[model samples]
Target: MRISAVRTADRFLPERLSRQLNPWLLRLDQMLDGSTEHAVAQRVSLIAFLVRIISAAIALVSQVIFARWMGQFEYGIFVLVWVTVVILGNLSCLGFQTTVIRFVPEYLERQQLDHLRGILFTSKAFALGLTTCIALIGAGGVYFFREAIESYYVVPFLIGFICLPMIALGDTLDGTARSRSWVLVALTPTYIIRPVLTLVVMSIAHAAGFAPTATAAVTSAIIATYTTTLFQLLVVNHRFQAVVVPGTKTIRFGEWFAVSLPIFLVEGFFFLLTNADVLMVGRYMEPDKVATYFATVKLLALVHFVYFSVKAGAAQRYSELMHTHDHAQLSQFARDTARWTFWPSLMMAIVLLLLGKPLLYLFGAQFTDGYPLLFVLVVGVVARASVGPAESLLNMAGKQKICAMVYAVTLIVNICLSIVLIPVYGLAGAACATAFSMVFEAVTLALTVYNRLNITMFVFAGRTNARPVKEEI
Candidate 1:
């Protein structure tokens, strides 16, 4: 009916507008048909892009409110602790969050329901258990070093530890949902619901006369994280039961871990590479400066989300193509993803840079000082975007060890450069360090993909010869 309507409208529409509308309508029709791999990936990428847009708005609003309510110092403290918790929570998954994306599609392709059920259950359990242990260790560490830690950060850091298990669980569920192309289910809990809930909880606490301190913000976060994750657990499990029949589960712990550990190293290094600048700035600079730098990074998320949205949508497709051994399709899709990632990122970076100083001023006037850092940081972001999610491709294709090695080397460069530059040049130094490391990461990953798979992963690369396929899954 919709197609009929579109056809009818196309007959009456002016040629100029119809030229524009026709291509998009045709693409929509292709997506609605859902027969081709390219169409499916495009649809999924569109959904992920929309979700990230909404999430970015919510996060921006929430961060601005927190900055206003707590002032720069307290907000900085809260940002530092919260970043720590999130990083640790994601790390505690030990790569199961991502490994699920690789294995679930392959298992289903082979009609291995037992393995599918096994992974779904095991990933969540492993994440919850590991994160819980990490949380306990974190609490103990805080207790043992309370006196040595800053008086203001101690309690908030302890409170932040309580959020780890839930955060980890949410991440695993996110991957599980993504593996099935449930974009809303995959992204909503952590990205949309959690930030909104945090703001609401914090607002209520403040209205009730609670002090707007780092501790209060962390308390609100704890409540929000638990609420979001438990609800996600119920929804995800219910959806899983509907799709996967009840049966005996097969737990392939050894095989899963063998893949996961290298992926863990890749992710751990990637996370540290991305966030090390902020952490180092926090270490050397005062809270206000930290707050300023954090705000700049948050503003940059508008541009960064393009890469993430593409990665989230593209990973499962990469795994599927690998399973099918369709090298031609895989090569085309990989190049398509790089184009999808780079152009939008370039546009968003330009728009954000135009509005960046004003956006930082929304956090506080002093934040405008960090606006110049945006120019430096965006170079690396665009550089990384030039390769799209080639790393995801590598991981799904059983090249995780090499990918991990690439990220590890990039991270070392980032850390060493940051250590030397941040103390000397402050935020600008950190930005330079991060951007340079990103360039290094992108070049290395592109070369790795080319060398191992004979596929050029860069956006601007021309067409190439297709390689003979010998591997079978």
Candidate 2:
């Protein structure tokens, strides 16, 4: 009897240990095993999640190094200039990035290769041309406003504008890759390669005796952006060649612009809403404070990546599912994604907050001052995650105008709150305002999703009675 009991214990112990140790492996196996919508979504989400994990690590390390190299004041200037350039570059895509995702899947579904080819070429060309124009206008504005701007910011800002065309092109390429479900190809160049290249270039410059200033850093970024973007463009074109084949193309500029403009509004508002806090902080505080706040926000990015990863993988899938009229599957998937976003985000938030001070210290001891703001900021990030990527759902479902309206309101609230509070409470006030805006944005988005699609978008929402809705397209 003793021998038999020992055998049973040995058998159960190993099995239990395997189950406990390799749960993610088991989940991964499930994800890759089938061709079902859920399975595909899971696989893409997992890939995107992993990519973000790597990107986050790379970005964190790079930012730390940059902060150390440039010191607080220069780092602050670089960050502010870079952030403004990035935001403008993305906006200059003029919604073509997301518009391509919406249109590509449908074009392929309908076997409209001509339309697909047209969009592939048109989006890049449109983004490049439009961004160039915007860049020129930005340069002119900088020239005219040079006297009014801070002397330190003027040169870097001018240099950063040179990156606009490439940034817009990169964004459009990302959309094309995503629509085709090429997750690695879609994400790797922009997220992984670009930052790595930026660090390498900056290090080389510093070694060559370039002063570790905002101008040097911005120059490195411009070089990195152009290099990464051009390389990405080549690779993407190569892939498209094999899959799409050569054919006569058609351009539907008027129709495409009609759809794209509203999407532009949506994305524009979202970008502004997300970055208004930083900009407002820069407006109200000194470079040292900006450095502290930016460092803290970078730490919080560890949590924010979860939502972005899920959204990146899920957007094309949402478009595909909507086109197929699979209301049931779409609703279920929406709920699943919300769960995917919230739990990981919640866990990350907890971990980041617990370790917040130490992580901020990595940037520098002074940065540790921003640690307390993490608690205030995490609430908003977690709240945004609670609704998952419902905005993507609405945009894919042809509710972009309404989605644009929601974001517009949220941006207004964020800006107003930031302006009102930053003067009073400083960094903490900025955090509070941003968090409140996030909560407001999440609630409005959740209600919009429920009312329009009959899908409960919140993480805690019950099973939805998903009825077939008329396709906006």
Each candidate's clash count? 0, 0
Query: Candidate 2: which stretches are off by over 4 Å?
Result: 1-27, 470-473
| Tens digits of per-residue lDDT for model 2, 95-152 | 9899999998888878899999999999999999999999999988998999999998
- Total clashes in model 2, counting residue pairs 3 or more apart in sequence or in different chains: 0
- Give the TM-score (vs. native) of candidate 1: 0.96
Q: Which pairs clash (backbone N, Cα, C closer than 3 Å) in model 2?
A: none
Q: What is the C-alpha lDDT of each candidate?
A: 0.90, 0.90
For each candidate in turn, the TM-score is 0.96, 0.94
Q: Considering summed lDDT, which 10 consecutive residues are worst modelled in model 1?
A: 1-10
- lDDT at position 22, candidate 1: 78
lDDT of 1 at 136: 97
- After superposing candidate 1 on the true structure, give the runs of residues whose Cα lies further than 4 Å from its correct spot: 1-9, 14-24, 469-473
Please, what are the lDDT tens digits per residue for candidate 1 over residues 1-473?
Answer: 44543475579988787877877777777876665877888888888888889999999999999999999999999989999999999999999999999898888878899999999889999998999999999999998999998888899998899999999999999999999988889998988999999999999999999999999999999999999999999998899888888999999999999999999999989998889888989889988888999999998899888999999889989988888887888888889899999999999999998999988889888889999999999999999999999899888888888889999999999989989999999999999999999999999999988887778888997776789643313
